[model samples]
Target: MSDADDAGHRRAGRPLETVLTRPRITAAALRLIGATGYESFTMSGLARSLGVAPSALYNHAASKQVVLQWLQDHVMTMVDVAGFGAEPWDTALRRWAWSYRDIFATHVPLISIMAVLPVTGAPQTLRMYETVAAGLASARVPTAQIVPSIVALESFIFGSAFDVAAPADIFETGALAESSPIFSAAVRQGEQIQGKARADVAFEFGLEALVDRIGRLRRP
Candidate 1:
């Protein structure tokens, strides 16, 4: 073929720019979840948000579950596990719990999704668990109790994360206030006596209590 004809053929076969990548896809997926939430987050919606065909997402992820696993691992990378090796076990647990709850407070949807999802393929998530488990073992917690204790602590953290988003008047009894005067008064008192937000104060209280209880479980 002539040089001009060869150039024309090369141009015809040139691939389109690769706009979709794992990072970009994950970012777009997170934005879609943030904007529309888990209930409305579908592969089709994600593709629409990324301005690509749904087939493009499939090129990166096999299914919605796979994308969610990627998101879970990415999110796990944000949780604070720095205290595990440097601080006392209790202190490390406290630091990790606070960071975990804070990160998930804005990602409540992921909390629900991840609650049902396993950690088999999520390496970051598994790393977090390993750190916490090692910390517990180092602290002399019973082998049988470590997993349950972790689960219990996580249950509190997840609930507290949701509570962080609750309105200040979430406890308002409205017309029923008069019927439960004691509870209403306590709520009002709690609102007034705070350096930290009420939800935070409650979280600290619960976390400390759990920590103390776990400490008592130490082997002799």
Candidate 2:
């Protein structure tokens, strides 16, 4: 009877720990920033979205940049490209590249910050780069080529992510039509393959092509 009463008491009590520490501000920031770029997304906007005044957010965050840093850190972790310690780098690199693409696709809205903002927060971007560099070292891809290779891979992946986020109108203005067909085709392609299959297929293709090019370049 006492145990039953204790169990009932426990059940009646709220588990407020998760509520007390609402650390998943990452999702909130990403959703807001992704949908409305940081420049225009205001405290009032966040409050409206959260069903609170512009003041409530102060409990969780101070500035938009804090929110941005939070989102950036969270997103980077979701992308598994950062390898740890010594191992054969090929699999890690492939995994990292593919993972990076998938996460970007998942957070296309949040990733726009990567353009002008300096990388910051919980997950260290430099550490990720260093980790990849260490992996390339194991792969015998040449000491001098390590940094360049990493930079190239990052540029390709991030550029693709940005392409996904950029508005079609940006590429289709009056003078922009000359290059708009490619964007038009890409839009069609995005519509055609707007699912897991699309991202997986394109990333795999690009990653393999890049690895091959790097391998050939490193050849003696």
Q: For each candidate in the order shown, give its overall lDDT on alpha carbons.
A: 0.84, 0.65
| lDDT tens per residue, model 1, 1-220 | 3546546655887432244556666777888887878788899888788776888778877898878778877888889999987999999999999999998898886787778777887778889999999999989999999988999999999999999989988998889999999999998888777778888999999999999989999998
Clashes of each: 0, 2
* Local lDDT at 12 for model 2: 80
Minimal lDDT window, size 10, model 1: 14-23
Best-performing candidate as measured by TM-score: 1
- TM per candidate comes to 0.82, 0.58
Clashing pairs in 2: 34-109, 81-96
Name the top lDDT candidate: 1
